[model samples]
Every structure is written in structure tokens, then in C-alpha cells.
Target: MAVDTTPAAPSHPEGGDSGGEAVRPLLSGAPAEEEGEEEELDVRYAPYARRDAYGVMGRGPLSPAQVARLVLAAAFLLPLRLVAGVFLVVAYYLVCRICTLFVDGLEEGRPRLQGWRREAVLRAGRGLSRAMLFVFGFYWIPMSDRSVPNAEDVHQDQSAELERPGAIVSNHVSYVDVLYHMSASSPSFVAKNSVSKLPLIGLISKCLGCIFVQRESKGSDSKGVSGAVTERVQEVSQDNNSPMVLLFPEGTTTNGDYLLPFKTGAFLARAPVQPVILRYPYKRFSPAWDSMDGARHVFLLLCQVANYIEVVHLPIYYPSEQEKDDPRLYANNVRKLLAIEGNLTLSNLGLAEKRVYHAALNGNSPRALHQKDD
Candidate 1:
């Protein structure tokens, strides 16, 4: 039988090939691929409540010697992690205060941030993010030293007025994706409106000028929030000096092995998008928030001495006629590219479906689930 040559759409996380037989390619700028199909990646996407889908964020479990080393390392770092956490909180407050002071001075006429004030905010955000990630035992390793290029260098067709990327979209896996992105570029984000109320984290996010999406708010109210996202993107895209905005279209976290359907909110902005792929590669502790309790996931990472993550930044995706005409295609194309570059399988399940599946797994089902193909 002649082998099938066409690339099929990436598979669902539940029924997809592993892309490789649990292979842990050496750390590099690109996703390491195997000779052929990855071992059948049978992992399922579920809430952290279920503990089965998150297989060690690598090929398999760690060796006894490796486990011993990790334990010893954790023991040696516990005190430092505690002290660093406290110091970071204080340091982050200072970063926010400095940005706010500058912003207050610059807000004379244009409500939108621009000029050197924006750069100061972005730089401060990145600095604080680096500190946070370090204290959390995670490292943000960019795939390449070439940072997000000026729109002129990477995608020139962008008109002088609207070329700079207003949106940086990425695949969401662990809860730490935001940390990694900020460490690379101080981009604002489209996050849940409720996030703005979450103590220090919320306060800092607001200071960073993040646009919050009301995921639970339904009907015209939610639509209004979505509209706000587009308006915000539009207002900021024309200015080269504005801070880049970032969002996770996946909207939900998945194991590093596959992608969930992307939400079109980011694409709705109709602005150029830069896709960044985040993969948490680990030998024992899976950085994925899937199937493990949220508290447990955080505690596990904190107890570990250090963890490594691969941050793959792909070329920016400029909107073509077709993409602009159909945001769904735009979102899918970007999602597809991230999956291919990250060596992850793709799925059609959006965050809603994932939530439904979680309920199903827990022996509960929605009374009338109206699933959308988009």
C-alpha cells in the first residue's frame, strides 16, 4: 500500500498520535521530530481534578538517580524559594509603581499608551516577570536570540499604519504561560475580567494594562467585552511605540502533546498576530495543569529545584485577504502553525467542549449541549 502523504489535520488530544513515541528530543530552538508518526499519544484533556492525562512532561518517568537528584536539589532550595518569593512580591510592587508613575505623567491627551512611557512599562513588566519565573523554579528559554523583529523586517506587506503586531497569540499549556510571555515581551493580555480582582496578581495585571475578557458573562454583555478587545487592539496597533498585546487563543490549558481548538477572540482584532509556542519539557513533573489539582500543581513546581521550558516563537502571521475575511480560518491557521512547530497534535475541542468533557468524565453532563463547529 502506498503511504498516505498529505498532512491530515492535527488529531484530537484524545485520539491523536503522540507525534513520536514519547521521545524527548534534546533542547533546541525547534521541535525535535522522530522518523515517523509519534507514538500513539493517548493522553486525554481533562481538568486538574483528574490525574491521568498528564504523563511526565517528557517521554516517561524519571530514573531513581534522577529522582534522588531532584529531591536533593529541592531540599537545598526550599529556604531560598521562600525568601525569593517574598522579595519578588516587594520588587514587583516597585516595578508596578515605577510604570504607573510614568504613565500618569504621560496621560495628557491620548488615553492609549505610546512613546517612551510604553517602553518603560514593557521593560518593567519583563524585568518583574523574569524575577517571578525564577522564584517559581521555572526558566523562560526563548527558541532563538532574534527577538520579535520589527514588523518591517519580518512581514513587510503590513501598511505603515497597521503593521506592528497588536496581538501575540500562543498555545496555552501550563498556568505559567503568561509568565514566560511577559519575560520575553511586555505585552498586555486578554484575560478573564474576574482576574482583575485576584489580590496582588490581579492588581499587577491591571497595572500592566491587560484587557480582561468576561468568559462567564454571556449574551450581549460578553459580546460587549469581545468588542472591547477588538477596539483596544485597533487603538494600539497603529502606534509602533505601543506595547504589544498577547492572548492565548486556546483559552484552556492542555498537555504539551496536543492543541485544543483556538478561540477567535484574538483574531477578531483583525490585527497582525505573532504566534509564540510554549512547551514545558520535564523529566518527572508535568508542568501541564491537566488532571492534577491546581493547588497540587503549584506546590509540586515550587518544591522542585528548577524546571526547564521551551519557548518557541514562530514567524508572525500577517492577515491575508482570506484570513481577514474569516477570523476562524485566521485562528485555525495560526493554531495549526503553532501545533506543527511545537510538534503537538491538534484537536477541535474548544474550551467549552473541554469543560463539558470534564463534567462527563465526572459522570455529569450538560442538559442540552449545543456545540459549535467553530
Candidate 2:
């Protein structure tokens, strides 16, 4: 049997071969080997000897430490949001007044000039809005799927045609969507006439050139809200310095996972429609409706949100080039794209996309009311 002189297989220390184990080259206190022997040992043992270190810690749910920190942060930041909200209302009113004054003056001097001075003042309101959210810990991740870039990136795109304004529409997910747009593009939204009545926010809307649409008044005078939106779009298109008109075609905010059918009013802007899709990747901690109630939920989420925001500007779709140039058709095209982009998140959560076959169609669903053919 040759005295059983074969070598025994090597043994590893405790912890097995898990990636978290640490390894050493040789036994501690062992004498150094000869150069040839060391080289031979390296060749023989290199592959199996090394061990991987543990990865950096991640926020899984919230640890005790994280919970404690979040609580403390919220305790400080929540009240701050309340105070800031008041300031925002006040700043918005002042800025709106200034803009309104300038517009009135411009109307007198050169009625053809499509300039709104309050946009500059709105910058302050926007800043305050961002700060309030920031103090609460709201974070955003930059998204890359959409061509509708942020204000800075918008300038870099030669094809974007900053001088040629268009109706830029997006799905409504949350009231935060409004703030997000204001921060990134400073575009005016088609707000309800009622929003214009809110103490401070309302006055601001009226003064800042918000296209206030009235549901009941649909005569030729202003098309009420619809007509107002058209005028706003025309004004924006006429100015080389104007912010793109941002509209929530869906007309209301959803829980962010589902997309509603877009209201046709935005499509009626007569300008080419610039379809924009915005998605917030909150991972496991995504702010859901169940997890977060309406307005109060938003305030709470602001404090615990991650530190990044993603705004994916997909390729801009032009209504002028799209088949069936009707606003409803253009809206469908946008809805389709959004459906594709947000399908996984929405469907996984059992949410359905709303349909907008008719402008008169309205539903309680946060998104549009569409039959899901899928």
C-alpha cells in the first residue's frame, strides 16, 4: 500500500469560503521560504488563498441607529417645513405681483412682447420650495431616459429649439411633481382656478402667469381654462427666453406608480407637444400612497427620502410630426411611452393605466381612466 504516503487535502479555517473571510499568505510566525520555493508556492496557492471583504453597509429598511437619526432629523425638519411653507406662500405672492405688474406694463408698451418679469421672482419661490423639501430630506436621482433635460442641459441641445416653445406635458404623480418641474425648468403649469384661490399659493398662481383653467366656463372668451392654456402656450412660444410650458396632461397627481389618461387641454396648446416622463426611483423605500397619506405623507417623506433624484428626459416627441395630430392622439402616444417606461413599477403594484379617449372622461383614479388592453 506504499504506507499511505499521499498528502492530505488542505483545510480552511472557520467561516468557510464565504466572501467575508480574511486570508493570510502563510502561517503566522513561519520562517520565510526560499525565492524558488516562494515562487512555486505562489503559483500553487494564489487562486484559493485570498478572501473577500464585506461590502459597505446599506440602509435596509431603517436600523435602530437610522431610525433614531431619522426621528431626530424629522423632529427638527418638520416644523421647519411648516415655517418654510408660510414663507413660500408669501414669496410666491410678492413675486406674482411683480410679474403681473411687469406684464401689465409690457402690455402697454409693446403688446407683442411675450415677456413675464415674475419668472425672475418665481426663482425665489422655487428656491424656497426646494429648500423646504430639502430640509425634510427629500432627495432626487437624475434620470436619463428622457430627452427633456434639466434647465442646464436644455441649453446644450441644439435641436431643442429654446426659442421655439411647445407644450411640454408629463404624467402627474404627486403635487411634488409641480415643485420638481419648477426647480428644473421653471415652466408654468395649467392649474385649476381653485388652486389660484388658496391663500398664498392662489395669489401667486394668478400673478405668476399660471394658466388657470375653469371647468365650468368653456365659452369662446378665454376657452376658460382651455383657452387660457392656449394663450399661455402662445406667449411662451413667442419668447426666446421663456421657460417651456409644463403641463400635467393627466390633470391630477397619482401615487407615482400609475399613469392616468392625459387631459386633452394640454394637447390643444396648438404648438408641438413635448412629451416628458418623470420617474422617481425610491427603491424599497419608494413613497407609496398606502405608506404615505396625501399632503401629510409628502411632508414626512421629505425627511426620510434618499439623497438623489432622477429625471430621465426621453426623446422629445413632436405632435406636428406625429400621426393624427389631435391632442387626444398625441396624448395617447405620450401615455403609451409612459406606460412602457413605468410598466414594471405600476403593474407590479397592481396599478393600471388610465385612458383618455375623450377629454370629458374623468375618474377618481389618480392617473387617467383607460381600459387596460394588456
lDDT of each: 0.62, 0.49
lDDT tens digits by residue: candidate 2, 35-65 = 4433333222221122211100111233476
Kindly give the number of clashing pairs for every candidate.
8, 26
lDDT of 2 at 314: 61
**TM-score: model 2 vs. ground truth:** 0.58
List TM-score per model, in order. Answer: 0.72, 0.58
Question: Of the candidates shown, which would achieve the greatest lDDT relative to the real structure?
Answer: 1
**Which candidate has the highest TM-score of all?**
1
Output the lDDT of residue 371, model 2. 36
lDDT tens digits by residue: candidate 1, 89-204: 67776655555564542222123445564566667678877888888877646475334556565344554544667788887778788888887877777777677777566656
Q: State model 1's lDDT.
A: 0.62
